[model samples]
Target: MNSEGDLVHGRWLDAVGRDGVQQAVGLLDALSEAHTIRRLELPVHTMLPVVLRQLLLPVMIDALGLPRTRQEWGERFHRGRFSEDERDRLAHYLGPRYGDRFRLFDPQRPFAQVAGLEALNGETKTAAQLVPSVASGNNVPLFSALSEADELLLMPGEAALWLLHVHCWDTASIKTGAVGDPQAKNGKTTGNPTGPLGQLGVVVPTGETLYETLLLNTPIWADGLEPQDRPQWAWDERPAGLGCMPAAQPVWSERSATGLLDLLTFQARRIRLIACETEQGTRVHRAIVSAGDRLAQTPETEPHTAWQHTAKPKKGQPHRRPRRHTSGRAAWQGLGTLLAMTLPVESDGPYTSLLLRQIADLQRGGVLSGRYRLGVETSGLEYGTQSAVVENAIGDDLPLPLRALLAQDDGLREVLLECVDQADQVARALDGLNNDLRRAAGGDPLPRDKGSRPSARFLHGLDATMRRLLAGLRTVDEDDEELLERAQLAWEQCVQMAADREAESLLAAAPPRAVVGRTVKSGDKEFVYRSGKAVGVFRTRLASILTRVAEERSAKGEEAAAA
Candidate 1:
């Protein structure tokens, strides 16, 4: 009836071609027999191919008639007239030798005779003969049948529709090239070299075109059919590690349309949405009825009309108003209380004392029990002071002891002086002990009674005694000038001897300069005081004293000269 119908019919023929015609007929016959014709109101454009392959062909061959072979149609039908110009163009483009390709299918011969069969007259044919008869030998007949059918069925108005269907169906098969070989000139032979059939002049069809056509013609059918599901495609040139965010879901509410719109606008800016549960047993209908009735019963008023219409306050009576101060004060008081509780307790001197106090408080308050004696033997002061000192120095307020030592205060100075003296004495004692042991280990130069080797306990006791002595000395006050001076002098002498011994030891050990450097601070300022600079100051003073003596000598000489 329309171009769409022609397109549908053409596609059906193309789908059936020759091989599928029998199957195509059977499906259509079954539908026809079922009397469900109304349901078959599919667009002819979309239905034709599917009906031909899936319903028409089989029933037609079994119930109606088998398709004719090309040779049976004779030379008149197969050999069509062409212009001289067309022949010349074909010869020029395909080459003169390509004429041989056209000789394969000779439509002049009778197909029934070629197959060694008589024309059908309601007689049954054996499958063996039938199969061999349609074998085609050097020339296939199916492609010619499809081409002929396509020409017969397609009208000028139907050309576009048929092309669209064919294009869509052809795309479904992903066919590779031209439908027919250019070298073939004879109308009798038909084969597509690059069509879906992978041979020249062969037709290929898929059901997609039929489906689309049916949908276009019969829109009502779409109501029952599930919409086709298609995955969205996107090109992401993002780096390998990237990913896309998921789409957000809608949140529904029973608020007024304006209120809902406002909420949606707010939610668009927020990262997450929260759902509030409605009251239990509050039916939506009941809520709507209540709201509508309430609105109807209420009188319309301007803004603040309720306040304006209220009874006037009694004269001379204190006008009662909502108190805003209580809540604000309560909030502020809470904040102050939090700050007070969180502020660190300020404690000076040893943290051990503060810790002990806290422990005692806890025990008395029943927060701690069971004969607990939580001793914190800290070597630093309490937290606040430490925090302040470290923050001032290095953004970390250290404890009092560490701050004192790091800053090299008077206390640290006294301790360091004490350590130096103690270290020197210990070194001297160790040297003496080593020498004695060495002498004993070797045959003594002075004769001595042989006995068991000296007990290691003696050396251990010596070390312990030295440490205790140093510890006591380290606690000594800086005001003990006499003791400090003596210790300092002795330390200097010991240091000189130790340096000499270290040099000799290095030579004896054959230690590298690198080892020596690692063992000592090489910078001049590091040990300038210990390097006899203080001694040099003394020498300079002595020289100054000598100069005074020389001046006195010269004065006496001048007096003698005057006499």
Candidate 2:
């Protein structure tokens, strides 16, 4: 009922019923004239408070045993067997709780001045009164009569007993070496003592006596308390009833402490299912409840059946609902999955989400658009970057076998050839433009028609041809240094050519064209030329021609170098 299905309400009801029964029994026993006994049935849980009292009461009574009263033990002091020193020491140690019945005597007397003084005093003085007065006056008779051994032997037991008594006093004084008696004045002392005796005055004997009592009674008391009929106090003489109490076990309260945790886990799964069902617009609470009951009944054996129960749609359902496609948004989900895969094991949600968003944007913008769609798009980019990194990791002067492997392995070769070919195409295109511009500026004739302009198709074809040649070189198995050198040079030239062509295009389009003539200025310096338009046209045409020538030169150079 308290979310854990425990019968807490039932427990409370039982406790109330038990208390009523106990009160009724008490009233009936009191009113009965004849000797009468009644047995009542009380459930252990309901009777627990009473049981605790029954358990502790005997222990308290047994603990207060045998001295019967503190006065009885004090009266024993007047027997005259103990010397005056012994009497004084005992009184000092035990304090006024025992009263002043005992007294110390002078050592010289050797015997009592009056034999058994109570007998001498006759009716006037009790044994308690006469002995303490006789014993109190001097140190000599006390020290003379008792040997050190006898004194020491008498001490340990009495010390232990006194400690137990002090332990029972809740308000026992703790102040050391104060003169006035503790029991005489509400267990408080006069003043704190500066001396060692003052320090001793504060020393409570409780713990030591408690230890002795526990040692003496533990085994016997433990056995006696084990029987259900025995009072719990039977174990009290064994260190304050500790031995009688049951050892603590794992409890329901401990299990309930983690109740919220278990509930949250169940709720999380339930919420997920609820979200899915609501999204699909299913209304079947009875079915959900029935499935849950079934799950609870055979949780370990029919897990899949329970799952199916939740998944099953209601009867007479429509064949299909209208589907809203969010493929674009779903694509972002794929990107998220990809980014999550690449992330370090320790990476948390925010970093992963941020990276996924960036990747998703890149994919949608066509920046990363290609055959490698979904998760693979991000993966491909990662692979390409990593491959380049691996290649560069191997230095320029790599071993011959490694170089051959790099040049011939289909994957490695493709990567390298693509890089090389791109460089070559760029260089040739730029170089051809720079050369044409120089020629036109030196008064060379320039074609005036659009036919003289570089063809887009031609430039594209040149790029395609270079790509294939580089791809072929990547397939080559032989490791010729000269071939490698030619490849490198070709790649460098291609990059330089591309730059020159771009520069030529910019120069031709710069302002003050007439004053500049057909000449392309390098910096502040300008060379003379014919027409700016003509030079632009001528340079573009030559660049296309030169690109083809550079490719052919690269091929021939590669073949010759290989040979």
| Tens digit of per-residue lDDT, candidate 1, span 165-228 | 2211211111111112122233211221111110011111111122211211111111221222
**Residue 369 of model 1: what lDDT?**
38
Model 2 agreement with the true structure over 254-291: per-residue lDDT tens digits:
11111111111111000000101233232111100000
Worst 10 residues of 1 by lDDT: 286-295
TM-score result, candidate 2? 0.17
**Over 4 Å off in model 1, which ranges?**
1-408, 411-469, 472-478, 511-563
